[model samples]
Target: MNQDFVNNLYDIKGKVAIVTGATGALGKAAAWGFAYAGAKVMLTARTQSKLEALYDEMKAQGLECAYQIGDPIIESDVDHVVAATVKEFGGVDILLCAAGMNNPKPILEQPTEEWEAIMDANIKGTWLYCKKVGQVLKEQARGGKVILVSSTRGKLGMKNYTAYSPSKAAIDLMAKSLACEWGEYGINVNAIGPTVFRSDLTEWMFTDDTARTKFLTRIPIGRLGEPEDYVGVCNFLASSASNFITGTTIYVDGGYLAG
Candidate 1:
């Protein structure tokens, strides 16, 4: 393999990226990775303190990055973020929709309020980001990338995850729908479906040895996902390496779906 050519295929130098839900484990990891790859990454989340912390971390590493305040469901906030990013970094080349939530409760125990919360955070929020940022990408007319963070539960349902399962399942179509509409604009929309990853979100599930064991047993790779497990894929998806790829969900599971 020609090393230089291979590197060029994945190069993200001078690109601009916006990562929502960037304070979360996967989002933060992805933001850092993109910044490290020489892209100016803009991080967005509800918590300014967390965003600042991540900004400081990037600065210390001499990577190009910044953070902005945003709520996925709020159109004004999404507009603000896109405007702010364009003002600072020129335009968006990659949009990573990593903001999502899940409250695993059986259908009988799942209240309407919980279901709404899940939809608001995972579905509505993601679409807002995609729609707003997608417009920016389209105007640029330079082709762009959108990576939505999905989950294995979206593909294969599980008990006690009523709202979450359906919410993520929505992302599958959302990505495809956006891809079809935006393909002519040269914008690629795709998603990542990770399984049983250990993050702040999954901490409680892993705390119980029995529960953790049961989850791990499902992965043929015999391991749970770490934060690092997501970076390479996010980086690839955000870079030119995946230029021809769109409207597909890449499973980052440890062979969980295979089984």
Candidate 2:
């Protein structure tokens, strides 16, 4: 391939990326990945200390980045984050909604409030960010990327994922619906569904135990995922390389979904 073609592929330099759930494991991975790839990143989350800490860490690396405090479920908070990103970075070219929660419990044991909380965090939060950030991309009239986080649970049913599974399933559809709705505006909306990644929530899966051993049997690759495994995929989705790809969940599950 020519140099121009090679350079254009996966090129995200100078683009502005807003990463929600900036304090979470995937959030940190995406934020740093984008920044390291030369995109100006705006980190947003509900916790100020964590936001500042992340911002500081990135700043120390000499990466162009800023932070905003916001809750994905709150409209005003989402609005401020969008506004703050534009103010800090001039304009947003990508959005990675990594803000989500999961409280796995049996259907009979799950409370209404807890279920609603999961919905609010995973579903509503994703919708709110897409709605607000989409407006900006529409106005700019520049094609943009929207990366929503889903899980393998979104497609496969798990015993105790009463609320979490449905919430993620909704996200998969939301990405498709938004992709169709915003295609006219040149905005690409897609979801990334990972299977049992190493994170604060899935840390126990890394231990040598029956649960870990049992789970490994399901993965064809015979391994758990790590935060680093996400960097390339996130970069692909955020960069111009994926301009024509949308409305689908790219499963980063080490062939678990293939089985």
Candidate 3:
């Protein structure tokens, strides 16, 4: 193998990527990163207006991108998004399962509906998207990449993280199982576990002094993560550089998990 080729393996030119929850802050950042790396990106979310906005923004930036509005929790919607992507882009090469929700509450106080919402949105949604995209990759007989966005809460326990924690934990494990089943089919499944990224979701946490201090104390880097912090890892995972890597979770948590 040529060393030069291996080093340049991170190039994702000409690949097609489908990103769920593209309307959200983190999701949009991930989609932009993929487009920046030369991949044709398909953004999916429940809100058509938001998706269209993002699509137009990316296009204005001279990026190859499209959008599909649908709920990932519905199998039909998932199928529709996959079909649309295939019809428009020819085939799928990468998937970013960034759709998820978080409702902070103590286990004892967490409502049943809250837990159900988190599980359905995070675990089931991610699984369905991967399943539909994985089938496309299998049919094409071409290996591809699947990247699940998880959290440090999945790896460690924390107060008021009841619903969110278990859902992300499921995501991390699902990536491993998917990798085991799809590696022979040329698919790579992995996850990125981030901690306290600056996003709309974390706005409340940052505003609360106690919450911010508690969250920051665990991180060795003593700072919160920015959306750009995850771009490099996302690019690496979606590229050939990670061809032989699967069934693992890379923490982009600013050393939060090290403690």
Whole-model Cα lDDT of every candidate shown, in order: 0.90, 0.93, 0.90
Cα lDDT of candidate 1 equals 0.90
TM-score (C-alpha, index-matched) for candidate 2: 0.98
Which stretches in model 3 have alpha-carbon errors above 4 Å?
207-210
The residue-by-residue lDDT of candidate 3 on 12-118, one tens digit each, is 98899999999887788889999988899989999988888888988999999988889999999999999999998999999998998888888888889888988
Better of 2 and 3 by TM-score: 2
Worst ten in a row by lDDT for model 1? 197-206
* TM-scores of the candidates in the order shown: 0.96, 0.98, 0.95
Top candidate on lDDT is 2
Least lDDT summed over 10 consecutive residues: which range in candidate 2? Answer: 199-208
Clashing pairs in 2: none
- Among residues 3 or more apart in sequence or in different chains, the pairs in candidate 1 whose N, CA or C atoms overlap within 3 Å are none
